[model samples]
Target: MTPPVPAADAPADRRRELRADCSACAGLCCVLPAFAASADFAIDKPAGRACVHLTPDAHCGIHADLRQRGFPGCTVFDCFGAGQRLVQVAAVERPVADPGVAAAFPVLRQLHELLWYLTEAAGLPLPAPLRAEVADLTGRTEALAAGGPAALAAVDAAAVRAGAGELLGRVSAAARPGGRDRRDADLVGAVLRGADLRRHGLRGAYLIGADLRGADLRGADLLGADLRGADLRGADLTGALFLTRPQVAAARGDGATRLPAALERPAHWGAAAPVRTRRPRRPGGRGGAAGR
Candidate 1:
């Protein structure tokens, strides 16, 4: 039988519970993924080695100045609370965490990501059956995350993700009637300024460097959509679905960009895009007194 996921045993904020608490983590991310030197990362680091900037106590040496120190890539990385969960649940003690943790972190991260999505989906006005499905899947996913490292290592994470994706697709369809579907489209650097893209399905779309200034993106489904350097000045994203912090932080959005209440305006973005308003012309014609 699957074990119940560990919780705080009292009323708590699920959103906060699902977020990264690096203080509680063992710095799993610093040692897990290989880093390629690029615009995002300053150095190429091999996997399974602690980052050069990682402190003895599992803290980042350049936490406040990561971007300035050439590690902007680390700024947007979130494990959705996986690292800490492993530290707490597995009782990992480290100068080096157990090899099992290295093996299990990726699997646990994926499960935790699914949990984040399911939690958001539950809040949407899904139908009764869909709501129940979300609840069931959420429970199952929690059970998967609750397991020991052995069980986590044995899980077919991709298969579980595929199942969850299918369910999310159905949920998206129900929630977005007659929305345009653009799943997995390579729309890199496309100019879509001032477009009406409400309720559009853009799952897994490559929107890299796209110009999206002043676009209306209300209720758009942006699951796994890459928004790296995408311009979102004055774009309205109210009610957009499945839009995560990393995605928002990667994109360029000014204060005028209307984000969903759940997300914060990225600090890097400019204060506000210039607002344009048309001046009313006098009925007389062009260059009339009012127009002047």
Candidate 2:
């Protein structure tokens, strides 16, 4: 047996940052994945079926030792704000266990993830032309986040994408000096640590070779954005609207990568880091068995 990797303790400040309103949820995240008996997972679970490792109270069995026990994937998965966006904001009153709720879960989950990116994007600098819209956009994002999952499921996705795209265009403009007409600007090879590109449009922009450590890409629209060779260490891509699957699939990352809601790290990235042991598993939660 692989010697158990001791869990790392989370820094107090960081723990406060990752804290979320999980109480408003019905534990949707733990049960929705397409699980199979693979190196990363010890069980085979179907879509819509709860994972065997999930306790009756809807918590992970292996809340600790995630990497050592072969469920490291859970540790790196960030719902960004998808869980709260759906369960608390959008689906406020409806219990996820309700008889009529099953059919929309998949779509709702994806939509909530998109919302997370957009909300994050809204914080970026806006062009003079779009600055006026940022306040309204921010308010709207907050409202949507507070809407329950059921409310989110009922939204028109196309409209949401369009709004996010508009915001991205504004961010792209602000990135340029003197507001140069850089609608097609190239940011490849730029060192952009902690740069705020929230809600900015970078559609079809070139971002290869950018060192985006701690960059805020929340709610920034990235449709057709070229991200080849971009370094996203510690970058928060949460709630970036219009970020397509292919764009994310094409981007590269390592252990330091942090994605927005509902997205998992690439299998090639290896297992998620072990949870810190300082934070003991919440009382009454169970740890996963070696195999299911």
Candidate 3:
């Protein structure tokens, strides 16, 4: 089974569990997961097989050019620090090409993701009762994660996620007072630029390809929201609830975009086109003095 959450003063490393540390990882993601030749991948590859783009040093050979080389999906994927943690827990001394590590990576990943969500939930400001429940659940989940590989393999991650979802729902409801319930709304390719979505309940909403430029998303609950291809230029997502790093990484944003405290601006965001402003015309006709 998975481990319980550590103490309140748990080691700093445990508290910052979701931050990806690729340098410390054994490239489990490049070798363990199966990929089909869809819009996401350039070719089909079986599970436990390393990608052709992976280098001898367990790094992606095309890391800097993934999107240009037909692997845009790779750019959005994140293991949430699970790859490195799994390597340590599984005692993986060999390269990621080892079938044993590949086979166990998926299970460990699921457990780690649960830890990530639970850790986030625990930090939310909820009612005393709800906060206590979240603490309890987080502890239990952390305990499961601390278990050995055999225990992790036997964990029911879906069930844990379901339970955590209930707690998170309550947390969302409490955080976003008077928010609209737009759960699972089909907003694909929407033209909602500059819209006021502050404090809205957008859990699991399909916002893919939506025009959200300059939108106000403060305090909005975005758990599980599909933000792929959404334009977030000049948008303010400050204090937005449950906005995962992967969701932000999948969307498009410019330098003017504001994010929640827990998240970081994705590196790809630096490539976004800069926002332009029109210069004001002179008070008088072109080449004429004002008030002439």
* lDDT by candidate, in order shown: 0.84, 0.56, 0.79
Ranked candidates, highest lDDT first: 1, 3, 2
- Return the top candidate by lDDT: 1
* Highest TM-score model number: 1
Per-model TM values vs. the true structure: 0.87, 0.49, 0.85
What TM-score number comes out for model 2? 0.49
Measured by TM-score, how close is model 3 to the native structure? Answer: 0.85
lDDT of 2 by residue, 140-245 (tens): 6556544454564576666765776666555444533242232356888888888987766666778877888778877565656777567776677875544644
Clashing pairs in 1: none
Candidate 1, residues 93-196, lDDT tens digits: the string is: 55354678877889998998888788778777666777789889999999999998888989999999999999999878877889999999998999999999
* Residue 226 CA displacement from its true place in model 3, Å: 0.7
Query: Per-prediction RMSD in angstroms?
Result: 6.5, 15.9, 7.0
Q: Count the backbone clashes (under 3 Å) in each candidate.
A: 0, 38, 15
Better of 1 and 3 by TM-score: 1
